[model samples]
Target chain A: MILKSKVAGKLLRIMLISSIIFAVISLVTTFLFVYNEQLYLKIYKFDQFISVFYMILYYLLIIVYLVWLYKAHKDLVELNTMYPITPKGALARVMIPIYSLWGMWNVYSTMYDHFRPIKSTEKLGSQLKVFIPFYYFLFLITNGLNRVLLKSNTGLYEVSDILYLVSYSLDLILLFVFLKMVNIVMKALDLLMVVKQDIIDDTQDVSGQPKVSS
Target chain B: MNLITKIKEKKEYSLAIILLIIPLIAAVVMMYPKHEEFVATGDITSVEELGVEGSVYFTYVHEGIIENLYEKFSVSLTSRNEIEFSSLDQHQYENYTAYYETSDKYKHNTIVNAVQNAEVKTDSQTIKISEKSQKIMEKSSDYIGDSFGLMIAIGLIEEWNDEDFSQNNQYIISGTGTIEYDGTVGSVGAIRHKLLSAEMNDVDIFFVPKDREYYADKNFSNQVEAKKVVKEEQLTVKVIPVANLDEALEYLRKLP
Candidate 1:
């Protein structure tokens, strides 16, 4: 059993909160521009600055996530991973361009398969496996729909605009889903570490004095 | 016990280190945020060797220092992190919804007329905007305004005529004004930042709406304010005031 670091849990929380904040910022910015175009331009002229802030936050989140992912993969390798992948090998698949889109999907599937047999992580592994593909399709559809709607020049504030609202709403939902998945995994990891520590403490208490010969 | 020294001996210091370091990093990152993240910069298109230029625009986003401070305390107090829109203070959103609705409704007219005044005959007089142009038409960017009309009209005229109006083709030029149906130029708000952008990008000449009509606050007009900023800041970019499309064309024709 792994003894989790306090830093990892705190970072995970930060990562989750930052993603939500970033999304809310995006929503507010978009809402202001549509609801009050003139004032948005005149007053809140910090649009580009905000985007740079978003970029920095986004990159920071990615770094922390990859580090934890690498550690998890390392745990599998220590026990002879079924897929014959190293922690570095998994990272390479994710970071390499053109190959990454497919590579990241594969990495998720491999993790799911490895973890599916473990009693503690079985439910999470199964849930992730189901959700991963659904999330992928949702991502593709939302992007495609937006491109189509934008190019059509059908104008805004019409029947089709509802689709725009839907796409954004779905985006919000998926972001929550992604963060929730991370949260569940993190909590499970924490629980496993705590349980292991407790069992060790109990054993030490039982063996406090040597047993007398029977 | 040796992997992380302090953390290996005591796991809780890991949280302490992270809590202290994150806000410091965020503060540093905020110090150097940029004003422009460009889709295109200082690029002129050549249609049969005539230069046609357009003003660049970027999509928008929001951020505030208050949110960062709020987040620092949020994680410590609660497990459920609720998304809050009220965190952003009250804005022009409450009073200007009707204005936004009307402008957004008639937005296409501004774009179409700009193309038409350039006298570029389209397929049955219906303006088929470029894919990029279409995206900017919706309330998607700050560029969705009449101020961009003058440069776009000029650019279209050059493209349709297949020759630069000025014929010098030496200096990069750009500007802003509303294009009326009869080819007249009208005033638009917020010229100071646009002028600053032009200077920073080294645009040689910029056309602004001439403040011909007298008002109690005529100095607040696009042309007058642009000139004032140029004078005060000693901006290298020249600001030229024009009454209409013909006036701008006349000045450009006379440019040696």
Candidate 2:
């Protein structure tokens, strides 16, 4: 029972964190609406409100999750006291909220950027499956460079820095799209191999099982 | 158990793999630099070393103010910010008179000496002057107008119009070097020295006179001595009926 409860708590935390990440990204993008003015002055005004509402809803959900997290911890502590579960396991369950929040915050901005209107919405939606990890790697590289440059007295030429940042971002986006394509092909191959194996195994399995010599 | 065979025997995903590779290849090729010459010339230091110089031209025109033949039209020249010239109108046959004085009892004849023995040609007198002269005229609208305070309208045209130039032919004007005067002629003299020191190239100006008899030997940019067909007194030194840029300049100089 203690183990089951701990797994359920982890799953809940992951779900809440994912939702928060989505909400935070939507909010950040909404605020950067000024950047979109150049593409078309007439943006759908409701986009901003929708993002705001989503953020609020996510925050509320997070609060509810925190309450549930507290209850789950309490229940785990009781379970640990009654059963053979260790104190470490109970503490770990209690700390899942913080880990989840941290994970959500780290990736929220990038995930939100995938939805920007510059690209075709449908294409971006499909591409983002690959885009996320690709962009994470790109961000790590660029952010490291940014920090190194910050230490030097000779700051980067503003235009060059901006251009580099944009280029890196674009490269990541392209890589993400490529990875997504690869992922789809791999999945299709896996499915086909499974089906072929299943057909072969269907005939072979009955004999191999030493059929219940009933 | 036979992973290698399974991978090889699986229907080749050739279409999907090729589709993926094409875009990747295209992107890589497109990202390479395009224009080699422009990239080579992108250095700005050399371009800055080559000096740039320009001239300002001013063409003065007036109308609806010619009461008597001698009563010349008063013209005021100004810049975007301040007025530069305010002179009394005068008419002339051979040479007009310009009365200028520096002081209260001051007496001065600001003369625009004519190019002696030089024949003039050109329709608009202003066009025959230096390149600087043309530049000043082109920017005249910026210098003129009530925006700069003094609204000195000489004719119905609020501003100098190229269309009116051929009609009256009585356009009073003058030309001077754009020198920073430190309140003295000595400073003006210094300007000439500086210009010469820099080895500034002159923008050649020519005038094809209506009466070609004003010159015996005719060549562009060549100075010549010639006699005037009309007497000095009979010749109207007014800027009106100015043949070309050279004639206009000569007429301006002849004005007292």
Candidate 3:
């Protein structure tokens, strides 16, 4: 019992550590995405090449981190004898990278290829419509980890800043929500393992068979 | 373990589904473009002008008989022809001068003859034996409205089409106008006073085409002198001159 508890605790720790690392990486990348593009445009005036390169590198790091996380998750699940790998974990593992990359590709296309300074109020509204959704997802994931990365300003002169702040804050909130969902997933996995262990113990007398050690 | 079971059983897949849909919606919106439309209204006119300020010197010899004296009389005529003309009035004289100096040389040399021959001056004004044209009004581009509100008050001018021409609206109205003085001080006095009242009454539009032409044409020194009359339509509803229909339409669209 002690050994099993220790092993499960170790797995839980691994999951927590990996999730934290993943959240941190995603948060930093998003911050870099916003700050480097927006602030650098005003202050540093970096060219398009540098801006695009920064984005690519930022996303690449996120991809590598996610891959490392998934491998850790797979390894941890392989060690568990109490339950089979949940289909939800499999689905999450498949979706996280694919959808993430899809989202990143969308950002790349919009920023590098389609980006233009808005010329009119009507155009600005249309552009915001296209942009708000993808950012909303990023928001959910980021805010879940208790990180607040957006600021606000007032008046016409700071209108752009206010919009930026609001959009990023909303994105962070969405990201946080997603992270909570991930936590729910992790907790459910823990409960499933506990239930499976309970079932195996209860069935030992009926089959008159030696219980498999968890 | 049941936590994972719950995650497996009731996980929301809609977020990913929403992600897929947004881009498609964006793509549809981006691909379809809307055409912009502009509305315009007003009087339209164009103006051309010509001015000549020079002295004419001519000498002629004539045989004259007075009662008992038959004598040779030599007359020298020297005068200043300081004329300011609108291009419309000068159009007839320009062709006359061109033909007289080149083809005709001398035979049919009167200004009347020349006017009779021109393609544009098909209708000639006959001098009435009992009375002459009291005043001739000529309209020109320079014939601007005396008061800004006159154009708005008159039904003739509107910036944009309104369902009702009410007492209040902010839109521009433009037109050229002229009033003639019939050589008599009395008539001039009456017309001037009438003009003032007409402006106040929003009846200023009636003075433009006919009244102005009668006055200005009579004021001109001679038929040879240039006279300008701004066309009625040219006064407000501005239209661009283009060589072709397509170009004209394009130009019209570009107007404010």
Which candidate leads the pack in DockQ? 1
Q: Write the per-residue lDDT of candidate 3 for residues A1-214, one digit (tens) a residue.
A: 2122333333333333443444444445445555676654453222222323333333443443344335434533543533233324533533566574455334223322211332222333344445455545564454442232221111112234334445445544544443443333344334445555666678786576976667
**Ten-residue stretch with the least lDDT total in model 1 chain B:** B56-65
> How would you encode candidate 2's per-residue C-alpha lDDT over A66-143 as one tens digit per residue?
443344434433423342223344334334666533442233232234233323233443455445555455545555
Segments of candidate 1 deviating more than 4 angstroms: A1-6, A38-50, A79-83, A138-171, A187-214, B1-256
- For B26-122, candidate 3 gives per-residue lDDT tens digits of 4344333222111111222211110101111001111111110000000111111111112213454455445434532222121212122221212
**Mind giving the per-residue lDDT tens digits that candidate 1 earns over B55-119?**
22211112112223323232222222122232322344332344445655445555566666776
Candidate 1 residues A90-179, lDDT tens each?
888778976877876787787677557767777878887877776666656766776665554422323454465565666566667667
Per-residue lDDT of model 2, residues B1-256, tens digit only: 5866654454223322333344344434433322110000010011001110111112221211122211121111111111122223333311212211121111010010111111122233442223422332343322211110000111101122222321233332212111111110000111111112122212122111232334454421111111121122232322122233334434434534
Best by TM-score: 1
Best candidate, lDDT-wise?
Answer: 1
Candidate 1 local lDDT, residue B12 = 40
All candidates' chain B TM-scores are: 0.58, 0.17, 0.15
Superposed on the true interface residues, model 3 gives a C-alpha RMSD in angstroms of 28.6
DockQ for each model: 0.05, 0.01, 0.02
User: Could you tell me which 10 consecutive residues in candidate 2 chain A have the lowest summed lDDT?
Assistant: A152-161
lDDT of 1 at B4: 84
CA lDDT, candidate 2, residue B122: 20
DockQ of 1: 0.05
